[model samples]
Target: MLGSFRRRGCTCKKKRCTCGSMWYYRYDVTDPVTGKRKQKEAGGFATKPEAEEAAKNILAKLQNGTFIEEKDISFVAFTEQWKSIYEKSGKVKISTVDIRKAKLKIILKHFKEIKIKDITKLKYQEMLNSLFDKYAWKTICSVHETAGLIFRKAVELEVIATDITKGATVPKKQQTVEDLENGTEIPKYMEKEQLAKFLEIAQLFGNANDYPVFLTLAYTGLRGGELTALKWRDIDFKEQTISVTKTFYKKKEVKRTYILQPPKSKESKRIIDVDDKDKLVINTLRAHQAAQKVHDLKGDGNVFVNISQIKGQHLTTDDLSRRMKILLKLAELPSELTPHSLRHTHTSLCAEAGVSIDQIMQRLGHKDDQVTRNIYLHITKTRKKEASQKFADLMKSL
Candidate 1:
């Protein structure tokens, strides 16, 4: 359609004003979605040719079906909209949606209300690189994941032409010089000896449910969520293995109580063998089962159910952490250690005992995780040092 251009706020009274005010253009373009022609206008050109060139570019883009109408939406606002749409999509659990919301907050800190259309791949990478010093690699990755989803949805909605997160790189956090000198920073986990002491105190002073739960965690390396989802039927007392195929789900904001869902990933579904030689973990579980029988508290037969609570009251990962803290306080162990720390403990001790990393990965139901690999590497390195020291001692005797 033919369009018109003119200058605005010009005071010259001639048919053509020579006043140097900025130019504006008005044209009618078909709405790509509605197929209805609508008048659009833009201003702030310094000259007629510049304005005409801009109009021609817009017309060319529209003819090629590549025009993107500017939508006055902020990044944070669009992300919230996507978050809402995602929550209502029913593709994943509410708990997962909650996690996305948390990760999205980390991204929002860098791009609060910045226009979604304005973020290019370079800009996104800069934001990620800035996080390397402040956040752990996993946290940065999670933030990037959430950012990717938001941008994908933005692209799908035609808000932007390409996903800004597509080519962005997240820089891994590196160990500090002090960390190399003092050894890598210790993740929250107990040493083998410390775990023994913690379990001893748990068995001695803690409630009936405490020892078995922590012992199982330390021995099997089950995730806190996986443990909370365990049931009596999942345990094989005779075969001495525990099947893990599901996890506990919770979202307090949505009033979702504990529910059983599939394991976190396909690799998370596996069976873990109890130490059949010592029989401590299996016996502890057997004793726990017996006690439940005595109290007639076997409703639905969950393995990690808090028996001290009213019957059938389920245990969650949070509940396990709180109990672990109280027991740690009593045992004078590091209070910062969480129930998850037991999983790391299991990996470390297994590596020390000559269990191959591959076996440990399988037993722990992990495809691969950085923290798990770190524990394995650290323990294996220590073992290598011990081997060298022993050889030196033998040579000294010679």
Candidate 2:
């Protein structure tokens, strides 16, 4: 016995009995909450003084409110609370929210069983390095970003004093040679003779309903989404301009369904001028529309609709791309070209024809001339040669 009890000296009748010489301490106190008596005993000390000192330290901690009860809370429980707070107040997109959930699952699977304070930078670095080895650099970066966000939230909520991942270093990613290879294979533009041949093939093998779609893409430089969302009311034949206001997004799971949304940016909402050649193409479209009218399959307000149906429903990017691929195969064109390459070709043509950078930027719905220039910088040498030749011609004329 230590506190609240006096030590008793041993006095045994037998030979050298030491009943009270062993070092042990026992104390009794009342539980504040339950009003029950409680006994605390600790021992294995070499001396009575050591036992008494230990007993005194325990008593001081209890009186000073420094004793901490071991908590049963876990990392998973805290993370769930963090997620509820994030969702209610965060402005995260749905796709981004889903990605965060996935990253959270990976973290919980690896570290949730441990106490939050027990996690160290070395442990987080090891996990990040392992994941980096198996995943792409972008994916690894996303994981790091998501983990940092969670840890930051933890710090804000006093769940941890410091984020263990804050100082962890991710290894530099190795890039494969195949990733550096230039994959663009489409020609910038068809020469006059090539254009003639392409048109001949289009007339011979392409469906009448599909030719205008291809023509529109080649001339206007509209993205596939923008082309899919074009309506008849958006075309101003008298002004020879086409208004690009909206685009179609094909949902990942539903292939046929299209969701109409605004253009990617304010610059993308533009009015593109129709050239004389494109006007002829538009006339062909109108003739086709009239022909469909006789069969009671006229489209609603859409400039381009399914030829076989009269519904106002629009085409999806995937279906349009598939149709264009079939047409390209039938015309004996290279299979590597996609519908998007048509817009590339349009930009290339504008650059080669000595169009002003500003005009090209506007026509392509680029936010600034630098965007147009950056994409077509490979043509700078060609432009230089053209400029030199033009200067020579000007001098000769003078």
RMSD of each: 6.3, 12.8
Per-residue alpha-carbon lDDT of candidate 1 for residues 6-103, written as tens digits (9 for 90 to 100): 88798988867688777878878787799999987765677788779878877888788787775658998898789888988978776678789998
RMSD of 2: 12.8
Question: Which portions of model 2 show Cα errors greater than 4 Å?
Answer: 1-196, 275-278, 281-285, 288-300, 308-312, 368-375, 388-398
Poorest lDDT segment (10 consecutive residues) of candidate 1: 304-313
Whole-model lDDT, model 2: 0.68
Measured by TM-score, how close is model 1 to the native structure? 0.75
User: Model-by-model lDDT, in order?
Assistant: 0.82, 0.68
Residue pair clashes in candidate 1? none
TM-score of candidate 2 relative to the true fold = 0.59
